[model samples]
Target: MNLTLKIWRQENARAKGRFETYKVENISPDCSFLEMLDILNEQLVDKLSHPVCFDNDCREGICGMCGLYINGRPHGPDDGVTTCQLHMRRFKDGDTIVIEPWRARPFPIIRDLVVDRTAFDKIIQEGGYVSVTTGGVPDGNAIPIPKKNADEAMDAAACIGCGACVAACKNASAMLFVSAKVSQLALLPQGKPEAARRVQAMVAKMDELGFGNCTNTYACEAECPKQIKRSNIARMNREFMCAKVCSEE
Candidate 1:
């Protein structure tokens, strides 16, 4: 299959950026999206020109390192599929694909199709984990959590923190990401110890990073590659409100 690519090109984070068009010939329908980019990069190298810069660590889609805005959607047309998992078969021949990076205030573009996602790490650092004592391996059933809650927690835990939610939200809200992180722990018995600090800290850091607030648009849920529900946002709000009110009381 042939494709016309309109990829964003920039020298660096501060350099002026623009879209540069190139034609990709003889692309296999089985090629992963990144593989198609690799072909483009190979052509650029042969011509001694700079190649497009995009993020991709584990091409298998487990790491969520590959975050992209394809055409217009967060991860292309496929439902609940990460950028690395997107295959070229989904697109037709002679398609003009528009590729861009995550457009959010916090995730400033570092170059063409590559944005700094350090803000996510900062939020996690504030409080997105549990503090367990270092020792030998603990038994699996030590916590004794209910099956239903455990399953729900795992569902929320599936979030890869790809930032698609924020990129898709008009307000650039990080609520969906933050909520998934919060709910994954808040539903578990082991996470109860640090639940209060986790919720308040994550949200506070999210605001500090200049990410906007959720306005019930549900766009985040719609764009999330993990299909993490907006209900997690509701759970986070209730948790934050209760934590704040109880602290005040």
Candidate 2:
């Protein structure tokens, strides 16, 4: 199928960026979205023109590095999939696709479709781990955690820090990403010891990094590739309130 792609091009974070259009023909319907871009780049390189730059590692969708705003939706029109998992068949022949990087203040563009996501790293560093000393791994039955809690924890842990939550939000909020990190740990016994500290520090760092507030628009939940629920955001709010209240006591 032949298609037109209007993609964002930026030289650097400080450089002015603009949309550049290109056409690709005879692309296979089975070709992944990144593969289609690769075909486009090869054509550009063969002509001695600069190729488009996009972030992608582990094209299997586990890495969450291949994020793109396609036709105004995070990760194209598909649900519960990353850009690397998107196939060309999702589009119609002769369609014009608009692709752009995550448009958030915290995620500044580096070049053509790549944006710096290290702000997520900064928030994770603030407190997204089980730091308290727990002895060696015990028997699986030793903890005896409720099945419901374990399932929810595992669900929350599925978050890949893709930044789609932020990109989908009108306010560019990172609440869903941050909440998933917090919930995955807080629901487990090993993480309870530092849960209060973890929630407070991570939320503080998220705000400090210039991420916007969640206004309950639910866009973050809708666009998340992992389908991380907004209930995690609610849990995070409760965690934050408890932390704040405990500190005063």
Candidate 3:
């Protein structure tokens, strides 16, 4: 299939950027979206031109390193899939695909299709983890966790921090991402000790990083590759309120 790709190009974070169009021909339908980009970059290199810079570490969807706004949707038009997992077959022949990086205040454009996602790392550093040292693997049967809580924790843990949630929100909110991080720990016993502090710190850092607030639009959950739910936001709110109340006591 032949395709026209209108991709955003920026030299660096402070550089002005715009869409630049290029044509690709004879692309295999089975080719992954990144692979199609790779082909386009190869052609550019053949012409002694700079290649399109996009993010991708693991070609598989596990690592959230790959993210792109294709045709106005985060990670392309697919549901529950990342950009690297998106196949060229999803687009028709002779289609014009518009690709851009995650557009948000915290995620400034670094170059073509690559944004600095270190904001996410900063938020995580502010307390997205349980630091308790469990020296070795404990017996699985030692602590009996409620099945419901365990299931919910696992679901929340699915969040890969791709920033798609922030990209999808009209307000560019990080609540869905922050909430998922909070819930994964709040629901687990190992995370209980630091639950209150974790939620408070993560939410505070999310705000400080210039991410917008959640207004119940549900865009984040809809575009999340992992299908992280907005319900996590509700749980986070409760955790925050309870923490505040307890701290006041």
Error of 2 at 88 (Å): 0.8
**TM-scores, in order shown?**
0.96, 0.97, 0.98
Best by lDDT: 2
lDDT of 3 by residue, 1-249 (tens): 999999999999999998999999999999999999999999999999999999999989988999999898999999999999999989999999999899999998888788998999999998898897888899987988999999999999999999999999999999999899899999988898888888888888999999998899998988999999889999999999999989542
Backbone clashes for every candidate come to 0, 0, 0
Model 1's lDDT to the true fold? Answer: 0.91
Q: What is the C-alpha RMSD of each candidate to the true structure, in Å?
A: 1.3, 1.2, 1.1
CA error at residue 69 for candidate 3, angstroms: 0.4
The global C-alpha lDDT for each of the candidates, from Candidate 1 onward, is 0.91, 0.94, 0.93
Model 1 segments more than 4 A misplaced: none
Q: Residues 75-177, candidate 1, lDDT per residue (tens digit)?
A: 8888888988999999999999999888988999888999999999999998899888748877889868899999889999999988999988999999999
Model 2 scores a TM of 0.97
Q: Which residue runs of candidate 3 sit more than 4 Å off their true CA positions?
A: none
TM-score of 1: 0.96
